[model samples]
Target: MDNTAKSAAILNGRLAEETTRRFTERTFRIFNDADHLSHLASKWKNVAADKAQGHMFEQLETIKFNYDALRKDSELFAKTTASMVLGTDPVDIIISDGKKTLREVQAKSCNHAAASTFALSDKKYAEMMRLSPSDQHAEIEKLLKQRIAAGTLKAGDYEQTLRNLKKDLQYDNVSSGGTTYQQATEATNQSVADRVADEFRVKSALTDMHESGKRAGNMGAAVAGGISAISEGFALFKGEKELGEVTVNIVLASAKGYATGYAVTALSKGVTHTASYYLGTGVASTLARSNAPVAIASGVVNASKSMIAFMQGEIDAEQLSDEISHTAITSTASFYYGAVGQAIIPIPVVGALVGAGVGYFIGNMIHQSGLLALGDSAVVKAAKAHRKQVEAMCLAAIPEIQRHRHEMEQMLSQHFAERKAHFTDAFSAMDAALYEWEPDNFMTGLTVINDQFGGVLPFKNFSEFDAFMKSDEALEF
Candidate 1:
């Protein structure tokens, strides 16, 4: 292929791969949201249903905010956690952007019939009144530690709460809004019914974000695929392919691009997500949200191709091994390059793409150079193998060839002796007939000659032969 064709193929492949990765990543996040919601429901089972649901919405909104912030600045890290401190801490959720506290949310759910208002729980007020200041501080710290041990809070949460406690235990914010419940149901069901609409809104917004991301990825991939097809068409045309052939080539290329894109993207996402358990969400999110997945997908694709080639006998085991090693090393380089690129450019996908592309090129170049260096040795090894094979074949044929030669010699010697005896006998008979005028001897010589000439004589005896020779037919001959 020419440079133009090569470039087109590369572009098409990269675009397809990237498009697929983005789509799959978005899809994964959508499912992740569902899982998160389920976990939250289970975790907050002891809390009032309405309160738990409202808190869930609050947490999701915070998550949505963090996602938006990260898009604007990758370096900015934001997260939300449900506050688990005991004794009416007033803070239902904590929000941070990794550097400092952004907000401490006190979420309250109330139906329209009850009131569009909220206040600190009675328990909190009582504690504030009953406990001395120092004792209150100590008790709050003790509760924070207990919450941490019970898996209700993290170390970060513990630290943030302690910091707040040291600063006079102030509640930052309260989240209460007019809900959709117009008529008051039973007191128990009123809050739940009122917040139902709000819960839907929050969930829908998050879902829409995921869907939007997926659609964008799909659209980008489609554009890339179209461009790829056009490039391929031009390449095929330059090579003087027929119109039909060019069309077929373009279609096949497109189909393959899409198939590979989806397959590799899904595989890479699955691997990354599974690894996230060990890597932590921050590190995992960085990988998933960036083009590092592309590097992983690329390696997987190359490895798959190598395995297929080996199975089809197009590559030997040694070559397959080399390819696997090359893919692993190149992929690692690509991933690191992509990560660095993300850091430097911090423009989401673009930076990662540029870095990964450069890394792949460099890695491939090194591999190719190594192959070239070993080319002579490989050729010499092949030549030696071929020579040995030829020698073995010759050795195998020697015994059979000797057997055939011996048989031919025996047959030829026996035939020569038999011919010599027959010739001597015929000549003696002829000489006797010619010198001594013996008719019987002449007849015998003629018979021998006839037999040697394949027995074409018509007469069976001398009397019949003499009668025919004296007839008019004999005179005509």
Candidate 2:
């Protein structure tokens, strides 16, 4: 048995009853019926979808009739276990397809597209914005004091303010700078005290303001220093002004203080603009492959993972459409055992064939997918042998592949966690008012991630700020 089928059998055992009900019920029902049992022995096939493979069955009765084969079997489990022992990368399914089909399915060429953001060294952004966290910390402390004064928070607000200030200041030198959080906080506190003290003894408001000209000076100095360093360091990608706009885009939050937070939200909601956002410079430019190519390959890889997860989620989808499906695990019998029962499952020739041989031969006939089966295949054995040819390659690639898979899985987990919270807010934000949406941009607004503070900040572009914030509570403050 193939790993997929083995995994499927494992999944059937481990799968949540409700999950099966929710996703694959339609396909399940079709294979599980009784009448189709006799006809199941014929040649079987699958329709290749743009993104995934389709599961088919002879009929419901055949599926219902031969519950033993479809159910997880020890022999099937052992076969899959042995395959894994030999070592195989699940992703090789697609890679083999690319190799055989002579297409861009596996190894894709990378190009530079501006939209997919690269992880760049923003040491300059950090160094220039070094004073920002401290300034914001001071501002937060003062605001905390005011909140306390207004009785907005409990008396413990002082300690909370100090704690938050201390925490916020730690990230200042994350990329660069010598000052510690405590040191920065102390500096900001001193300026805050000087500004407040000046307010107390001064007679004229202008004099007091002048005495506190320091705060504006600090903010201005921060901004000016940032701009100057940014210019000198050339931190941003230099691209055509009209075609690609450089942005030190500030994401202001409702929190009592100012801190730029540009959290990466889900790409599922991001605009699929067809252009390279980066001009191929710095580390981004130095990448072995062009960013555009990396992104396209990454997209294909991302889609593959997404499709597997989608299919898993739909394991029980057959229940929904009342479809039943079966596997081609072959079992043999003698004359003494044969007369007792024939596996009268759906396609007669197919069911008989499935019983006589492994799923590989019959499934191959239907889909012409050599990639799907490899138990006795030359191609698979060669790949496995080549992997062993390099001692380090076998050890390194397999574990690394597994590790990377887990890492991508974790990334997706984080992405979905963030996505659910955002979509929840979005649906809540629109509520009954969502019905007012129109193509002319009347009541409905773009749902793009224009702003970085929170949620899917919707807009075709960052051209409209007022419209983007009109709904989000996170943005409201």
Best by lDDT: 1
Instruction: Please provide, for model 1 over 1-477, each residue's C-alpha lDDT reduced to its tens digit, 9 standing for 90 to 100.
Output: 122222232333345445444333433443344345445555666777555545454434434443443233222322334433343455554555446765554433343211212122222322221111221334455665665577742444444444444211122231121222221122124344335433433443344334333433454346446766777778776986677776776666556545554444445555555545457445766666554555666567667877998999998887776666667666766667766776888875677667766766765566555543223233445777899999999999999999999999999999878877887899898898889987667778778877766775566556877898888784433
Q: CA lDDT of each candidate?
A: 0.50, 0.27
TM-score for candidate 1: 0.41
Q: Candidate 1 has which clashing residue pairs, if any?
A: none
The segments of candidate 1 whose C-alpha lies over 4 angstroms from its true place after superposition are 1-239, 312-319, 340-350, 371-477
CA error at residue 6 for candidate 2, angstroms? 53
Write the residue-wise lDDT of candidate 2 on 350-459 in tens digits.
33223323332343343222243323234444666787788766777998899999999999999889877765665555554445543334223326222224546344
Off by over 4 Å in 2: 1-388, 432-445, 448-477
Compute the lDDT for candidate 2: 0.27
Who wins the TM-score comparison?
1
What's the TM for model 2? 0.14
